[model samples]
Target: MPITTNGIHHEERGSGDRTIVLLPGFGCSIACWAEIAPLLDGYRTILMDLPGHAGSVGAHADGDLPTLAETVYDACREIGLTRFIVAGLSLGGAISMRIALDHPDEVEAVLGIMPWNAGGTSAGDPVIEGFNAAYGDIETITAGITSISNDPTKTTDLLHTMPTVTEKMWRGWLGGGAFTSMADKLPGLRVPAFYLVGGKDFVVNQAKQIDDVRSIPGGRLVLHADLGHLACYEEPELVAREMLNFLDTHAIAPA
Candidate 1:
């Protein structure tokens, strides 16, 4: 793992010409995708830590969604990444879509795992609102994490990362347009997109997410009736298999 001069920490893993950039959810680091990355042995994976998280050093509260998106994009460019598949979870999911929408030529495809926009563009998702309401409350975040996660060990790991979260980042999520709607833009999306959400998700509205994906051109949705918000961590095998299937269907073969 290496931290760039700009303070964006990233690591390249696996092998192949085609690359898949993996972005972690809010308050998560590259370790969030540790298990799933290896499963995608056919493609190289670039794991990144967003500003104000883990090894990265920056103030997220100072920027909005586009700003953060550009931060990630610039970091990728610094790493010499050109065209690649951008994939992420929760907050990361929304950023990935934004990146795809803004740079269709560079982002070959996008995969959003329970993206933030899935909860509708209105006031805010109940889950996200609750987080905002209980900003910096450990018990609240812990309870929320426990409720959405299926694996005990994964839950523990997530809890351990909580201390690194800054109040400014939390505020950024509120005022920085982290939950802003991209509904109008999805209809004009140029690249292929696939969205995966758990039917029992308490964080993002699954039905709304389905409709969101449908709006995109050649968009596909995968529903896991039994999974929750952290489906990838709970069941890495199932998630990876579905992801690989999507890639295969689209003829995105390993380089």
Candidate 2:
């Protein structure tokens, strides 16, 4: 087991020299990468539990993206990760970019899977409205999950892990991640960036995501035409394949 810093718990896996820190989406745990982690065989993967999520402590009442980003960066630093790529899904994706933006010299690259930035999904968005409406109701959450995912077992696992989240952490993440935007900062990003978008994702605007990613000088976008918001969970092998290919093409080896 690895140490927990600032209430953020993370553990390392794989023995490869290259390292990539993995962050899960809001309301999710490191378990989000259960299927994907094994596929990343040639890299040291750091699976992290964000504040207020599973295996972590509560979050600040006004925990915004920058604050969250700093907390994550500090935690990684505590673990002796001086230089590495940062990758995340949804909320995690946004934080990964923030890490790159705030600490340019430390981050090798950034990988975002449906990042909730660049005027993507926000507090008043219909998708977020639905999430708000279904927050505490298991039935509504299950229905929402069913609507988005084609796999039942993964859905079950997701729901099984949902109860570990408290109301404060949920709202804190919404205020910090779901309601924030990084549109103004992306064009100035100094590191290599890769964004993966699911065409059928109801939670994020695919067109806006494409445009936002394109705005970055070195950003690359990949569209999964048939996948939805939980693309990684639904097709881990495909996502891992793309991620590895991007890293190799960019020669983002460990420093």
Candidate 3:
């Protein structure tokens, strides 16, 4: 795995003209992209483990969103990618938004999955609070992840393969502060964007999620009715097809 200054670990594949950067959610690693990557074989893809997760343990800078976004930007710069389409899931979506907002010149488009939007408190507040409360115990946190993942067996296997983090690291990430700060910046995005959410995602209000991103000039929403928060895992082929179509429609360079 290649390492970045901010402690992210990544794997690069393909040699296409267009680059697709995959950012996983909390507690997940590059392994989260296992199913999606093969579908994007024609495009250059970069899958990264966020700090303190998987191969990037001990690389945590600040749990805050801006710092994490800068880390992502640095990683992309290090890899010689001047611009790319960023596709992020959950927490990754929040980071992608920050990157798109802070580095518009380097972002061609954004695909936000179950994204956390800019709002101090909305219908999703209780969901976030529940997550924070559960983060007090690692077992609880793990269980929560398993409950939400589309494939519990695969998700558990992937998680069990990673290096463990301290309670503080887990708590800091799930405490909700970082997401709150990230969500507060949604209204300022200027790039073309796609917002995706599983139709069955109870953790986030799908209607609100769509409405939030729809407010952006060129943003549109796509809902996978049969999937949940882990839509990518539950419906990789469908998600991949939708993403590829979006890219094609936006005239994003192919890998």
Candidate 4:
């Protein structure tokens, strides 16, 4: 069932004490975390759609990363999560970082999958141009994302939701208009941070991600050479195990 969080669409599951909030990548729904959510066996889980995608499609317009973060924060508060961990992929990863940065006291830990270093910076030109060219046409945009994805067929639903994604979302989220340099923020991070970088994710710079990890007091980076951008999709079980262990290590109690 779809519930509202300050009018935002979200879903909740699990019955554990500590909660894990899962935010998906572009055009993704709570379904994006299906394979991994179960691995988080003993914790409460909340999965959400960003403003312009999935269940929350078109709920808000002209929103920036921080704006989206606030929406999610409001949702979390409504869901009654006093102490929780946040994890995301791509766009979600960027938002997770924002959440951790802005509310250090609330977010217990963070896990990012190909997350961007959110501030006044963007990825390479090729990736930016690709989205710009396919902005209005759903077919074109879906095809573009499918081409880079590790498993195109698995992401069909995400592709279908592409049409709802707005140009502002494209420019601000994917096209890289939103940013806050992590170089200066990581050292000051209050939680444990982990990044999983795909070897073939051409959109993000692996080197910079590693550097971001180095800055954190105890951040760690895991690289998978055979994987592409949606690495979690390619080997969800493996990634889930890793995610579970990382959380367990940092978690006050085992989930």
Per-residue alpha-carbon lDDT of candidate 4 for residues 1-255, written as tens digits (9 for 90 to 100) = 575645567777776877899988765677778877877888888888877776776466344777888888888888778778999987788889889988988999998987765433554456657776777877778778778788887767666667777667766665544444546777888888888888888767777788788888888788878667776566788778778878777555534
TM-score of every candidate relative to the true structure: 0.92, 0.92, 0.87, 0.90
Residue 235 CA error for candidate 3 (Å)? 1.9
Segments in model 3 whose C-alpha atoms lie over 4 Å from true places = 120-126, 136-138, 158-168, 178-188
Residue 229 of candidate 2: its Cα lDDT?
A: 80
Off by over 4 Å in 1: 59-63, 118-121, 251-255
Show how many residue pairs clash in every candidate, following the order shown: 0, 0, 5, 4
Every candidate's lDDT: 0.79, 0.79, 0.72, 0.75
Which of the two, 1 or 4, has more TM-score? 1
lDDT of 3 by residue, 1-255 (tens): 588776778898776778989998766677667788888857899998776677778676446667778888888898788989898887788778878989988898888777665442353466566666764466766767776776676566435632264445566655633455444456677677887778677666676676677566777777777777777666778778888878888646535
lDDT of 2 by residue, 1-255 (tens): 555546778877786777899998866788778788889878889999876677765434234778888888998898889889999988889889899999999898999987776664644776676766676899887777777676766756668656566677666665445666778888999999999888787777777788788789978998888877877788899889889989999746645
Number of colliding residue pairs in model 1: 0
lDDT of 3 at 161: 37
Task: Give me the displacement of residue 246 in model 3, in angstroms.
Answer: 0.6
